[model samples]
Target: MQKESVIKVEHITKTFGLTKALTDVSLEIGYGEIRGLIGENGSGKSTLASMIVGTGHPDSGEMWYRGEKHNPKNMLESKEKKINILIQENGTINGLTVAENMFLGKESTFSKSGNVNKRRLIEEGSKALARIGAGHINAADRIEKLSFEDRKLVEVAVAMYNEPEVLFVDETTTALSQKGRELIYKLMDEMREAGKTIVFISHDMAELERMCDSISVLRDGHFVGTLQKEEITQDTLKRMMIGRELTGDYYRGDYEMSYQEEVVLEVDNVTWGETVQDISFQLHKGEILGLGGLTECGMHELCKIIFGAIKPDSGSVHLTDGTKITSPSSAIKSKIAYMPKDRDLESLFLATSIKDNIVMASMDKIKKGFFIPPRAEKELADEHAGKLEVKMQNTSQYVRELSGGNKQKVVVAKWMANGSEILLMDCPTRGIDIGVKAAIYRLMEQLKKEGKSIIMVSEEMPELLGMSDRIIVMKDGKQTGEFERSEVLSEHDLIHAML
Candidate 1:
């Protein structure tokens, strides 16, 4: 028997200038149920969610909340209706305290006599953090001081603090670690038990299969279908999402540790503060060295150290030719590229055009004397962006308008345009759909075949196992285990080292 619908949309149509975002879409989400939203990048999943949360509006549609006509002008109105959302990108304001971000636009609650009670605000923020199993975070600290993972948790606390009747999680787990993901899972389970609703959006098919009561798919602004929990599988979900049969292994096929013996780059006893301690590693020609660990295990800091974004206090990073890498400019000059874990903040200039961002790192190659010829820059950007299959209306489109997966593609395209011989990819496929993930993996394999070295740092165990020629596991700022590619290697082996 079908449960009563808590939320419903009919004949929803939305457009952004010349692009049609959604068309004639309709769906129903039941109370006390987890509904999964799956689609390729630009398939209108986020668009639909944005409309429901009042961050956007439909060109023509009717929405009902518990059988009432629901048309909210803004998120504040939706909040009054007890509906909330955890957005995909970073939502917290910089230069603001955790408590301030948690209670943004609602500070009047803590005000008396035209003055705010800062102490009360922090105390309430602490309670909110504790409710989501994240009491370790200091509510008084600045939001910028927290790591990307912790900041994401703060967004979760913000979304849940009001105890909404409906919660929308859009591509949130991609930024989280195992512990953080477990916390979200526990929270969703608790909400369901309490008769609340969850609308989960993720590109990870396995995650949806495990967490969702039913799965819905969208393709090119149209609703494809929905599958009950019993009918959900990785293959079926992929088919519905991409509108085709996806064959063969999504990752590399062989277990062979293939690479050359020539050392391309070396990290010699690198130590950085309390997070990274006496870590050393070598990148060989045509190698994928995987770095894995828990959220606080310092793997991310190590990537920055190797890329010269953060200088090591007691050690050095050098190329095979004895060139010291001590800054980003030097690293880029040395033919080294870094795709940071935080793509929007570290790796991309979101406010710029796609063509400009793609050609930013290759200025030398695209310039003519003292001027950058527009034709040369456009050609360079167009070639690489096309190679990556980045879905954009044109190279002139602003990168900030593109979807998350497509934004990641722009980041990769920039490095490829630079002809960088050694790549430092930290969570290269983070927040990307299956189709884009496959493209990236294929690109990595091709780079390897061309003798370009890569160091892949990821929190996803399956990615490390599937893509790395050698895996290095870290715990508490130290290397705990190392494994070579083999068919017998399992996630358990990696988890044991991480724990």
Candidate 2:
């Protein structure tokens, strides 16, 4: 059977100054199909989507929507033709209510003689939310009142309300819970039934296999190939996406390094509002502990608690070396480092130079008394950047120009340069490529060898299993189970414990 093409790209090439974001990439998505776009960060997946939505323009070639040639000058023009994009970044206004955000520009429709009709606006927004199976959200509630997952749902609601012919979801599921993910999946099915085409981008390969009718691989601004469902496997997809066969374990390799058996850090019956309840854990010197759980299972809150990002209402954390710390400032003073899950928002200074970002964590190292030595700072930055294998033209280049993987490496380099002993990493490998993931794992091993204790929080089951000497599973703010690396636990067991 011949498939109906909804959108077609022919020899599309987009260049940003000297960098080739896309190189003569050609692809097609059929009507009602969910197409997966897989690639490493900076591989041009986002660039292609931006070009398709008219936020970006190709240097050469053309794109077609339905049967008509499309050369959308801007996002408004593309929206006029029923093409919408939901970017990875949140685009909603924080001050607005959920209803107002959902309707946004369309709120003018509720105006009666130029006065805003609040009642009608809320009513319409409520109905729109119901249509997308998100009726639980209060239309009048402020956007800031909702959690990150709920905010993401509102963004999806806005896109669905627009009723576009083609929708692009770029790495949105990582923020969502399993239930929320299911809700989005159901909406995708409903949209497909209504003849909408979807371009889905995610780091989770299992999800892509389940949702996508076909998958396209991109690497270094070039289109590698597209594969049908039957023609693709996760390993095959990884190989195609990165242009190499991934070897070794995805996590920590076998090592004989042993900790002092003395607990270096301990959390005693910690409570963080309702999210984390009576949680207790211990970290020994030179030990890597893995935290695994479902989205709402308190693992994230636990990490934040340990990192001093959030203060626990009850209980106390103490360093075994006889130092007491109460805040993130104290934690940093104690040589503890936290690599946040949301790297863009929490860890990185995006507009700053890579050199500046690398040195941001440890300014005292390059300081002589109260004065900062610029020469020493530059030398230290260069050394760490080279050690991390950060692929940048120059250390002075803005961090925003680096790929997601390289940006993450800079985060690691920052803490490593500071000589941090206890590292708190929450989803460190999220959205990074296999090559970079391998590099990070190798770094973890090296850190262990240097007597740095790591507390890794990851959603990927394999990562938790492969990297940690011991794994702890949490559910509903409580520790449900624990496994030693020698125990050989399965993903099912971990998922069960998490759920």
Candidate 3:
């Protein structure tokens, strides 16, 4: 006999302006199961999850939870009914303390008359963090002071604190390192053991195959199919997602360490407030130099220093021509571009149009006598958007409407439009689908062929091994090892250095 579903939806359809996000999509999530939701970007995976968690609603559909008609008016209502979600982006508000963010909506739980007991709030928040194996985070600290990984853990603590019957983890793992990923995976396993349901949305195929009981595929706002546990494979899921076979390897095929020896950019003795320590490296003219480390390690900070987003306390970043990059403007003037790990917060102007963002970086280049022509801006945006294969109505569309993968494309598009010679990409492919990953990899190869240097900072070991001509590893704000690309190199070697 088939198992009873904990939640069910029927004939769900949602539309956002001219974009049809979902159409006649229906699925049942079973109790005590981890259901992997896989799809390419803009494939309605997040849309469906949002609807279920009450962050969004369908124009036409019916949903039932525990055999009752269920339609939550907002996220708070869903949380009241033991349903919660950890979103793809950082969910914690900036300017709030860790305890304040943890108990944001449920202030009455610690309210006395009209005043909130801050002490009790911190006490409970610390316990919540401990429950998720994150006791190292201080509840009294400001949320903004924490690292991106720690803020993610705070979100996880909030989501799991209520002991929800249903939890939607929307690409949350993409922001995490191996330790954080394991914490979440262990929590999911415990939830399964307790007969709860977890709707996991992710672009990582290997993670889905390992953690899910069954996998569901969505394609262009439609439910393609679901694979039973025995039927799930990377190849099968990829075919279902893009509706075609992935013809070549997902990463770069060459193993030979090939790049021009001309030193284009150099970082020497860079240190930043204990997060980065005495890191030095030379980026070559046609090289893909990989920086691998744990999320808390200094590689991400090093990328920022290289791009002049963060000034090192005791070191310098300069070019072959002796141009010292002191700030972002100087970096841009030196033909350097940076793609930060936190795309929505750090990299993009979310409230603006795609054309504006693409042309923003190239304003000096596209300007005509102190005034950029509208036609010139449109032409430049359209050219790079087309080159990047950005799926959109037009360049005039707001960037907030684009999917995660496409938003990343816009970040790349802006730099490409700027004619940057040096690229600093920190976690470039985080939370992106395989199709888009392949596209970005191809772009990297093309850039390398054209003698544009790249510094790739990533938490994924496989990506570092696959793309780097030279790999540098870091642990606890210090460089531990470096390796040249060879056919014999493996993830094991990188992991050794990272630890």
- lDDT for every model? 0.92, 0.86, 0.92
What TM-score goes with each of the models?
Answer: 0.96, 0.93, 0.96
lDDT of 1 by residue, 1-499 (tens): 1348999999999998888999999999999999999899999999999899898999998999988988999999999999999876788899999999999988999999979999999999999999899999999999999988799999999889889999999998988887888999999999999999999999877789899999899998999989999998888998998989997487889999999999999999999888999998889999999999988899999999988889888989999899999999999999999999888988888999999999999999878789999999999999999999888888999999899989999999999999999999999998888888998999999999999999999888889999999999999989999999999999999999999
Error of 3 at 425 (Å): 0.9
lDDT of 2 by residue, 1-499 (tens): 1248888899999876677889989988899888999898889988898898988889899888887888999988998889998766567788999888988877679898899899888888888888888889998999889877788888888888888999998888876778998999998888888888999988788899999989999999999999998987888998988888876466655633356686889988999888888988889877889999987889998898887888899987889766766788899989999998878778899999988998987897788999988888889899999998897777888998777788999999899889898999999898777778888988888887778899999988889888888889998888899987754567887888886
Off by over 4 Å in 2: 1-3, 255-258, 369-371
Clashing pairs in 3: none
Q: Where does candidate 1 clash, by residue pair?
A: none
Better of 2 and 3 by TM-score: 3
Error of 3 at 464 (Å): 1.5
Q: By TM-score, highest first, what's the ranking? A: 1, 3, 2
Model 3 TM-score on a 0 to 1 scale = 0.96
Q: Residue 217 lDDT in model 2?
A: 94
